[model samples]
Target: MDAQLGLRERKKARTRRAISEAAIALFLERGYDAVPVAEIAEAAEVSKRTLFAYFPTKDDLVLHRFADHEDEAARVVRARFAGETPLEALHRHQRAALERRDPITGLCDVPAVVAFHRLVAETPTLRSALLHYHARSVDALTSALLETTDGVAHQELTARLGASQVLTVLQELANTNQRRINEGRSADELASLALAEADHAFDLLRNGLAPYA
Candidate 1:
C-alpha cells in the first residue's frame, strides 16, 4: 500500500513538473499574459481538466513551485533541535540552502531560476502571486512559534511580529541576490557575502532591533 501511494505521488510530481515546464517555456517565448491555459495544456500533452486538477488557476500553473515552500519556515521552527531557537534553526536552514545552491535561496545560477525570478519581478500577476506565497509562510511560522511559546503575554502578537521580521529579512536577501544575478554575478560569488549579510540580519533579529532606531 505504501509503495503504491509512493508511486502515485511520483507520477503526480512528474505530471506537475511537465505542466510547469510547458507553462514556463510558453511564458518565456511570448509574454505571461499572452499565453492561454489551453495552449499550456496542449504543450504539456495533458487535457485542460488534467492540468487544472494539478493546478487550479492560471497563476498556479506558473507559481506552483512556490507552493512547495509555502510552509517551509514553519516546518523549520517546529523541528528545531533541543537547544536551537527558531531563528537559529531558520538561520541554519538558510545557510544550508545556500551551500546547496538552492535557487529559492537566491544562491543558484540556473538559467531557468534566473528567468523565473525575472518573470516574477516583471510580471504584475506573478508578483501578486508571490506575495500570496509569502503571506502563507508568515502564517505558518506564526503558528509554529505560538505552539512552542509559553507565558508570554500576547504570545500570538509577538509570534506574528517575529514571523514578519524573519520573512522580510529573508525576502530582502533574495531580492539582493536576484538583482546581483541580473548583473551577471554568479551564485558562488554571492554565497559568502550573502552568508555574512544574512548572519548580520539574523543577529539583529536575535539581539533585537532597538539599536537601529
Candidate 2:
C-alpha cells in the first residue's frame, strides 16, 4: 500500500513539473499575458483539465515558487535560537541566502533569472499578486512575533510594526538587487553590495533610528 502511494505521489509530482515547465516556456517565448492555458496544455501534451488540476490559475504557473517562500520568514523567526532575537535570525537568514546566491533572494543576477524578474515586474497583474504574497509574509511574521513574545505589554502593536519594518527592508533589498541585475551587474558584485546593504539594513532595525551621540 505504501509503495502504491509513493508511486502515485511521484507521478503527480512529475505531472505538475511538466505542466509548470511548459507554461513557463510558453510565457518566456511569447510574453506572459499573450499565452493561454490551452496553449500551455498543448505544449505539455496534456489536456487543459489536467493543467488546471496542477495550477488552479494562470499566475500560479509562474509564481508557484514564490508562494513557497511566503512562510519562510515566519518559520525562521519561530525556530530562532534561544539567545537570538527575531530580527537577528531574519538578518542572518538573509545574509546566508545572499552568500548562497539564492535566486529567490533576488540576487540571481543571471540573465534567465533576471529576465523572469523583469517579466513579473512588467506585468501589473503579476506585480499585484506578488505584493499580495509579500503582505501574507508580513502577516505570518506578525503572528510568529506575537507568539514568541507571548502577549507581553503592547506586544500586538510591536509585532505589527516590527513586521512592517522587516518586510519593507526586505522588499527594498530585493528591488535593489533586481535593478542591479537589470543594469547588467555581475553576481559577485551584487553579492558584495547585498552584504553591505544587509548589514546597514539590519543595524538600523537592531539599534533603532535614534540620533547617534
Q: What is the lDDT of residue 29 in candidate 1?
A: 84
RMSD of each: 1.4, 1.8
Which candidate gets the maximum lDDT versus the true structure?
1
Error of 1 at 172 (Å): 0.8
Model 2 bad stretches (over 4 Å): 211-213
Report lDDT (CA) for all predictions.
0.90, 0.87
- Model 2: weakest 10-residue lDDT segment is 204-213
Compared to the true structure, candidate 2 yields what TM-score? 0.93
- Residue pairs with colliding backbones in model 2 are none
Model 1 whole-model lDDT (C-alpha atoms): 0.90
The lowest-lDDT stretch of 10 consecutive residues in candidate 1 is 100-109
Assess candidate 1 and give its TM-score to the true structure: 0.94
The estimated TM-scores of all candidates read: 0.94, 0.93
- Number of backbone-clashing residue pairs for each candidate, in the order shown: 0, 0
